[model samples]
Target: MGDERGMTRMLLECSLSDKLCVVREQQYEVIIVPTLLVGIFLILLGVILWLFIRGQRGQDRRPAVRGTAPTPPSRALSGEGAGHGENVCVPLKETSVESFLRATTPDLAKLQVPREQISEDLEKIHNGSCGAIYRAKLNTGDPAKSKSVVLKTLKEPAGLQEVQDFLGRIQFYQHLGKHRNLVQLEGCCTERLPLYMVLEDVAQGDLLSFLWTCRRDVMTMDGLLYDLTEKQVYHIGKQVLLALEFLQEKHLFHGDVAARNIVIQSDLTAKLCGLGLAYEIHARGAISPTRAVPLKWLAPERLLLRPAGIKGDVYGAPPYPEVPPTSILQHLQRGKTMKRPSSCTQTMYSIMKSCWRWNEDNRPSPRELYLRLEAAAKTADDKAVLQVPELVVPELYAAVAGITVESLSYNYSVL
Candidate 1:
């Protein structure tokens, strides 16, 4: 009985010790599992922060893109990169006229007239400072649809600078687009020497010649007498103002504005021409005083060598003057006060006089001049306006005699 009791006690002790070992193992597992889980979470959070910082740095290295459209790739037309390796990029020092026109006017291809397709009439029209003008016919694919065009040829053997200038003018005209008051450019031929610019033919010649014709003859046209009335003057002035306003909006000014530069159509439409000076002014940002401006048509401040602004072209009086060119030059050189034309009506005279203000700021803007002329036109009678005869100087009448409308149609070419 003593041996049995001793063995039972020993077994009880062993069972209690096994129970305690199992409890200790369970406690160690609970503590170690939570600690391992927290370590894994901390490592994952550190990795996420590193990734976010890297993404922010990438964004900072590149410029932000704007605009609704994607930017086009820079194209190198000429110079090193042209016809070179695909990866090469070249920078252009200057923009070529061809490239400029292509960029600004995508329809330039349609406006181009092939040099071989043009046939000239051989008659020279008006000889101006730029070049001689001639009439030509463009051979469209359809014979009936072919139209007569004015060809202004550049004087042969033009220097590189001259050629560039001519091209710049063409591009500017393209930029101006088409308007009834402005002369339209059909196309240009720059492939060969003596580059020719094709323009639309205005049926009636320049206003100066037309006015001269009317003064010479008590002209009967379409069974009615053609006369220059005060109202008619207003009419002509209004059209010119419209043209000026158009140019002003484009940041341009007609440096030379006179009857000689105005082309009149059969329907009495006046279109402004002589864009060479205007283009020069635009390129230079202001008119140079050294230019040979028509003294009689220039305002006093302009004669004194002041830089020309939009108001520079406000004076478009008839070229025929009571004062001789030499005398006018002398008077201007002497700084003598100039007088307004006596032939103009009080209202017309007043308007022109205001344009001649010594201070350019005092002169009326093109828009203001347009409004004043429009108001004057409303008060005048059409029939009475028609009754008044067109006035021209006697010398102009004698000079322009026998130069009929038919003769003018075939004359003059432009470059």
Candidate 2:
């Protein structure tokens, strides 16, 4: 009886000890898991804090508005209804590139080009205020296929503001997407400094230069004689109006529309190019006061700092090509407007006069202009080239333009 009781007591004690051991193991595992979770959570929190701080620093370093006091970030956005006319203002904040990139999701994979793929020459075709432009060939993956592209790059050792604006412009094109009447972005090499915005090469260059070429007795681009008949002028004008219509669809407008901004392909296809001010006006709610627009091209409301309508660019540049730019605003203020050119038909001159109305409201809408152009184009002879008898040189052209030779852009090559 004594042995049985002792065995039972010992077994009971062993069972209790095993249970205790199991409890202790369970407690240890619970403690370890909580501790590991806490450690991981701390690491994640630190990473988030670091990113937040970095972003704050970037915002702090953003440059001030070019010609006015920097406004708060929450400026009013454009509205579709009655507020459309007043949507745009001036002195836009120069938004930073990285933050803008984060805000807008661009397909970097398609846009980012490797530096080695581009083959360029020593000669720069044109020197711009910010950088030099080169005519280069981009090597596609296929050995047989290569693309002729225009590489617009910044000046060496570019300043921070310049770099930011330059990259921001590239993103602006991405936002606009592709349009037949607008220059399309091919790709960009913006990963590092010495940034490049690759654009499809326009064989004939800007329309203004092409117009200057037309003044010569003979001019040809790839054997197509350069001449602008009254009907052909309507055709080109019609295409530009289409681009403006596209902008209207996107709740955007091109403020500085001129011959200088339109680039021509070999087949007389016009693609609108200058979009710096337009980018500012659309991306931000305003534009820089320092943005250079010829007074002749500016709407009256723009000069007076009133809210200009979207139809501002649709009218085409004010017709006083011979007037001194400095004297333009004064003349406009006195109610003087453009005189009709001799080459301008009564219908085209009437169209030009409609754009020159002192009051923005008095001007016809883009649709009206488009209809007129369409009606005129039906009767226009596509093959009949308008011929000019004079051979114009820079000096003679400048004398007629009432501007000094230095004032004229001579980067263009003559035919």
Candidate 3:
């Protein structure tokens, strides 16, 4: 009877301390749910923020002009390409030849000129290090209108890297859009190993050859006089400057700027060529020591293998424009300078002197140089052809032009 009475009392009476414990338990349950929800939300927000930051960094890695081929990475991959005082663009890198072909196949298909349509002239083929440059005629599929194109092709049995490097140059051309003063990339044949980069033929050959011809008597080719005047030099020079400005705007500097690189049409349309070094520095961040760019033409920085400089030109046609960049530095350091011709007026000479300054910073910017050229052009006499005293003989001409007399291909009549 006593035990039953105690149990009934325990069941009926609730202590204030016990009630407080039950309320604490309910508070913990409510607090735990809200805390867990808040933690999950914070984690989700952090993940979203991290993704956004990653996406932004990806966008920042792209090249300046969006070229067709991505060669390799150096300054461009780190997003550090910006803030270069006169730098125009930052080029990116690529993975493999297969991937490059896969990415470029769709676009390259349109650019591929049918090899069947291109008639290769065996006699005019100029073999290069990796391939032969052919003066071929593209049929345009139309027998009536055969387009003359220069075919820069890779030799068969080429390895992967050689093919990629060739394609990189093609992509570099695509990177450099259409500019009047620059040679135009008409089409290409990059479907397989024997890749052909088709460039529009500037029939006048190179500017140095044209100048050498001018040194002799005024010759008639295609019923037109191929002569150069002071005014014409400015005209050609201004055009070349426009090309340089175009490159400068893209953050590329033509390390070797001279007459040999510029090709003039009969109408005096000077198109700049030999951009292999420019593309090399643009893609690789350094010039190849084995390149053909003249030593006297390059700044001291490029000579010492230091960081390349901006702003670089022509005159009494450089005595030895063939001296490669490797040897030119010492020639430059020893204070050997090119002759300042009478027709190569003081203004233009000033520009040349400014470019040859030992210090890179001391050189004029491309814009400043262009401005000076334009100012000088305003006063130039476009009609009077500048006459340079003829070299005593053809051998002297060959020596000055850096070519052997045996290699000179004169027309049948001239011969």
Candidate 4:
């Protein structure tokens, strides 16, 4: 009886100790378990917050304009373009020659050119780079009914390569068709001797002709076509800039942009013509330096014969306009005859300098040049007219180039 009582008492004490241990474990579990979970959640939340903040900052610095052909990453691709630019990449559609050609210009096969005999007669009247440029006969050669038309007769050795070049020009015009400052391509011809690249003829003629015949110092005061006012040049530049903007937006480059290629309409608007050298950007990741290029108005990188690209116009020599950006005017001030116009605007010169840089990395594209010109023109509030002699004045164009002002000795027959 005593042994049983002892055993029961021992059992009671052991059970009480076990209950105490259980109570301690429940308290610890409630406190430490909740703390561990909260710590883990806080760490996760901090990580998520960091990611969100970084993403927002990236979006802020990105370029607002889309469709800008992406260039290759420089070491400096640290910005939005390089960093978190576009996460959802769009696949580039493969473009064929036929598809690209069809998309850009009118059907080349349909247009008709003038005969060689007629072209030869016009060639007798005028001859230059590609031989003669003639005033085409109406209804006979021209399809687009307009005031006047000039048929560019491509001479013999106008082989398949020449035909390809002609096709290229038409393609460029077709895509860049119908801007107020862009010349219209009436049609083309391959039929009946002498291949022709026919286009709308501006009665007022080209900017070169206008400047030659109009400015007071360039021409006789009485023979001035339009005063050599800053306003006029500004207007010309403004119109040209607009067309350039359009071209740049389309990622097309006008390889030959000079006074001769600019046609002035009766309404004083300037149109861009002769797009035989325009190129399109196919690669989007970056512009490679292995592309074919022309040298004359090309940027330095292009002159080095590197791959040609958009904004390469910046590297080209200055055009005829007496703007800043080129050293041509400065060279003229030094009394020297440069191969090309280098001065138009300081910004323009810089842009061209960048465009014509020996290294493709250094050159700017035509689109960049267009933007620079537009911004520069916008900030220029000074509309003050600088004094320049009339078109009749002797040596008026000495201040500029590509001008030969003279008195009208005979009636200008528009016919």
Tens-place lDDT digits, model 2, residues 1-415: 9999998786556753587657877899999999999999999999999999999998777543221222111111011121122223332232354344444335455788887788744235665445666777888887689878887775443344666677778878988999999998998886654567888888878887788777654443345476577777888888888888888888888887877678888888999877877788776788887766666678878867777767677544543656676666677878776666665667777878788777878887777788888898887766666655556576765555444555344344564
Each candidate's number of clashing pairs is 14, 1, 4, 56
Residue 350 CA error for candidate 4 (Å)?
Answer: 9.0
Cα error, residue 223 of model 2, in Å, equals 8.9
lDDT (tens digit, per residue) of candidate 4 on 176-270: 66777777777765432234567777767777666655543343445444554444565676677677667777666665566666878777889
> Which candidate tops TM-score?
2
- Against the true structure, candidate 2 has what lDDT? 0.69
The predicted structure with the larger lDDT, 1 or 2, is 2
Cα RMSD to native, each candidate?
18.1, 16.6, 13.0, 18.0
Off by over 4 Å in 1: 1-110, 219-225, 286-290, 316-322, 326-344, 385-415
Error of 1 at 308 (Å): 1.4
Question: Weakest 10 consecutive residues, lDDT, candidate 2?
Answer: 71-80
For model 3 the TM-score comes to 0.65
Residue 138's lDDT within candidate 4 is 48
Give the per-residue lDDT of model 1 (tens digit) for 1-415.
Answer: 9999998786656653587657867899999999999999999999999999999998677442211211111111002222233322231222443454445344456666787677644446654344557776888878898788787765432344455666777877888989899899999876444466899888777886676566544444434346667778788878988998899888888877877678898778899988777887777776555556555667656666766667878853333344565355455445344455445566766776677565678879888998998887787655543332555434443233322233232222210
TM-score of 4: 0.48
- Tell me how far the alpha carbon of residue 60 in candidate 2 is from the true structure, in angstroms, after superposition: 12
Estimated TM-score for each candidate: 0.63, 0.69, 0.65, 0.48
